[model samples]
Structure formats: structure tokens, C-alpha cells
Target: MNKGLYFWKTSRIPGKKQGIILAVLLAIILGSVSGWYYLVYIPHKKHDEEIQKKKADVANKIKKIDDFYEGQLKGGGIEQFTQLLNEIYQSRMILGLTSYDEKLITCKPDSCTFGYEILKSHVFNVQKKIFWGKEYSASFSNKGINFSGIPSNLKDNTTLTNYRKKRDVAAVDCGRLLNYIYAFNSISDKSDQIIIAKPPASSVLDVESEVKSQKKSYGLLFSTWSMNAKNDPIHIMSIFERQAFKESFIIKGMELKSKALKITGSFVCKSGK
Candidate 1:
């Protein structure tokens, strides 16, 4: 009886050992799964979050570019175009388009050779407005705004036989206007304080030329300036008229009545944005 009992105990010991081995294997499998959840699963989730953030940033940049082009296409007349130009100018200024540092020095000193290329492009762009965009003729800059491009309602008005004379005057006026206003040094030297403080009159800034070709009427714009220039301290006078229509005029109460009307109507600055 004792011998039989010893054999049974020995067999039970081996079975108990097998059970312990199985328990150890089960614990390892659970630990591996938990580790995967923490390391692999959580890390992948974070990577997805980062990717989403990058996509959002790209979307915002694209939206801004789209809005800019849309505004350009709308033309919204000269005032709107000028306003857009001013915004771009201001952004470039803030971004240090001409320079790299906070000193506000031009790109020349900063070795940013790209500045020349950008400025050249911008100058040409603005000049195009003066030449062809809308209301004021290319001659307005030269021959005065009163010059008529098409002389008469007469069918055979061959008076344009001297088209050369007309063209010459238009060219001269355009050149003179550009010479007075398009000086790079002069523009750069002009105080930013003035640009920020004073804007031009509503009419000048928001100008429209009503062109009546037969029964159809269309509004066009040639050029636009900063309405803020209206309040500038600098005395600017048109070369042809010699009338101080900008900063000086406002200081002298020339626009008192207009100002009153604007204020009474709760006039909001259109280009404030």
C-alpha cells in the first residue's frame, strides 16, 4: 500500500510542474500584448495626429493664396485693386521682402539679390495700371484727364490723320506723370508714418470712370493711391492741375463738408481691413 501511494505522488508532481509551465507562458503572452498597445498602437496614433496638423497648415496657406488671386480677378475697380496692392506691400514690408533683418535695411546690404527682381516686377505691374487699366487715359498722366481718345461721333472724322500728334502728347503726359511719382528713392524715402496715418479721399481711392459707349455704360479704373495719403503731412499736388489734393488739402479744411457728410452717414473706412 505504501509503495502504491509513493508512485501516485510522483506522478502528481509532474502534472503540477506542467500546470506551472502553462501559467508562465500565458503571463508572457499577456505582457507582450500590453506592451504593443502602449508602444506600437499609441505611437501610431500620435503620428496620425501630427499628419493631420500638417495638412491643416497647408490648407490655410492655400486658402490665402486663393483669396488673393480671387481679389485680383474681381478688379473691383481701382480702389479695390489699390487696396489689394497696399496689402501686399504691407505684407512684404512686414516680412522683410527687401531685407532679411530687423534693421529695415534694403536687400542690397543683406545680399538678397532677389530684391531687385521683385521690385522690378512690382514697378512694371503698377505702371501697367497707369497705362491701360481703366478710367483715366494713358494721356491723363500727360495730356490732362480732359483729352478725348476718340474725337467725334462723326462717322468719317479723319481728323485722326495726325494720330502721331495725339500719340506723342499721350506719351509725354504718361512719362511726366510717371517721372513725378515713380521714383524709387522717393517712394522708399517717404515716411511710413504718413502711409499708415492718412488715406486718400473716398472718391480718389474709390474712383470709377463711367464709360458710355452708345447705350451701354461701364465703369473703369486707371490707377489708385492710398487714401491714407490724403491725411499725410506731405503736400502732394498733381503736376497738371497743381492742386494739393492729398494731405495738405485735408489739413486746410478743404474737405470739411465731405468729412461732415461722411461722418454723418457713419462712413466706415472701406480699406481698413
Candidate 2:
């Protein structure tokens, strides 16, 4: 009986050491899983959400472009209307273009013009104004061209309340404004001349306002546009101004001013044109 007891003790499997090793392995696996969830899976989920949001935003912008054309056809067409279409075509090209030198591309001619004329008739006015010892060609930067023109008193206005909202407006406004500027710039480039102009002072008004109390004069419309470039994405920007006043609106000769505009990103274009 004693010999049997001694054999049993000697044969007892090394269960204590094996159990300890198994427990340690299980603990390690649980810790690794927890770390993966916190460091990788959660962040990946958040990144996907952000991407979806941006895609939605791009989709909405495309819809707005389509709607504008629909409305243009519904509205009657005059020579001015033709001019507007050309402007939009050019503007759209400028939308994807990334250059301060104004090399416009990425638009079909017809659509840009449609948008251009409508945008142009409402947003710019040229008047003689004294600023820093000179009379300059001036129009208002569209309310959409950032809050640069927003009066300090109106900083809290519904539109000027936030940078993101203002930036969005700038993008849209840039698209619309580029239409006219592109046409003009195209001509200027072909002729090898550069035209300098400035945004109108706060006081510029629609001449039609004086003719009839009930009728409203044309006003500036601001819009935003963005580019989806594979490498360097750009937000081509400009503010559109419309002045439907008499043809004598260009009385004030062109002047140049050096007010700094805030730019947030990069753009690439083919040429200086």
C-alpha cells in the first residue's frame, strides 16, 4: 500500500505549472484584443463616418449646379442670358483650376456661360471712390467671398457667424464669379494684357433703385465651389457682383489695392494664362 501511494504521487501530472501557463496565455489574448479595439477599430469606424459626410457634401454641391441650369432654361433668354451662360462655363472651369494666375480649365463651355450671365448681372458695381489716394475699379467682394467685406457691426449677422459657413459661401461664390472673370481674363490673356480691378466700396448701389421704389436693383450673389484633384485639391474662389445699371457703370478707371485675402489650400494649373 505504501509503494502504491508513492507511485501515485510521482505520477501526478504537472497540473499546477500547466494551469498557470494557460491562464497567462488567456490573459495576454484578452489584453491584446482590448488594445486593438481602442487603438484601431474605433478610430477606423470614426474615419469612415467622416468620409461619408464629405461625400454627401460633394453630392449636394453637384445637385445645386444641375438645378441652376434648370432654372436658367425656365427663365427667358436675352443677350445678357447668353453672356451669363458663358460666364458659368468659364467659372466652372475655374472651379477646378488651382492657380492665382487664372489658368481656367475643367468646364464645358455651354454650362459655364449659362451660370455666368445670371451671376454677373447681380453682383458688381463700378463707381468712383477715394481710397488711399486713388480712384479704382471697384465692386463688392460677393458676400460669399469670405467675411472680408462684412461690417464689424454685422459680424454677428446670420451669414458671418462662422468660418466654415463663410468658407462654404466663398467656394460657391468663387465658382459663379469665375465665369465672368474667366471670359474677361481669356480675352486679356489672348491680348497679352492684364486688367486690374477692385471690389466695390460698401456704398455702391443699384442705379435702378432710384428709378422705381417698388422695383429692386440687382445685388451681388455669393456661391461656393470645390475641386476634387487626385493630388492637390483646391477650392477656387471669387465673389460675384451684379450691376444692371446703365452702360456707363465703368466711369471710374481701374485701380489696384493690396488687401490680403485668406487662402487655405494649394492648387496646380498648366499655364500662366
> Could you say which candidate leads in lDDT?
2
Candidate 2, residues 36-70: lDDT per residue as tens digits? 99999999999999999867765554444434322
Query: Which one wins on TM-score?
Result: 1
1-273 per-residue lDDT for model 1 (tens digits): 999999999979989999999999999999999999998999999999999986775565445433432222221222222232343244334433433211111111011111112233332221111112233222222211121231111111111222212221111122333344445325443422122222222332221212122111111112223222221112222221232111111110111122110000001112222
Q: Under the 3 Å rule for N, CA and C atoms, how many clashes does model 1 have?
A: 10
Q: Estimate each model's TM-score.
A: 0.30, 0.28
In Å, residue 86's CA in model 1 sits off its true spot by 30
Question: What is the Cα root-mean-square deviation between model 1 and the actual structure?
Answer: 24.8
Task: State in Å the error of residue 46, model 2.
Answer: 1.0
Worst 10-residue stretch by lDDT in candidate 1?
A: 259-268
Q: At residue 25, what lDDT does model 1 achieve?
A: 91
- What candidate 1 gets wrong by more than 4 Å, as runs, is 76-273
Evaluate all candidate structures by whole-model CA lDDT and list the values in order: 0.29, 0.30
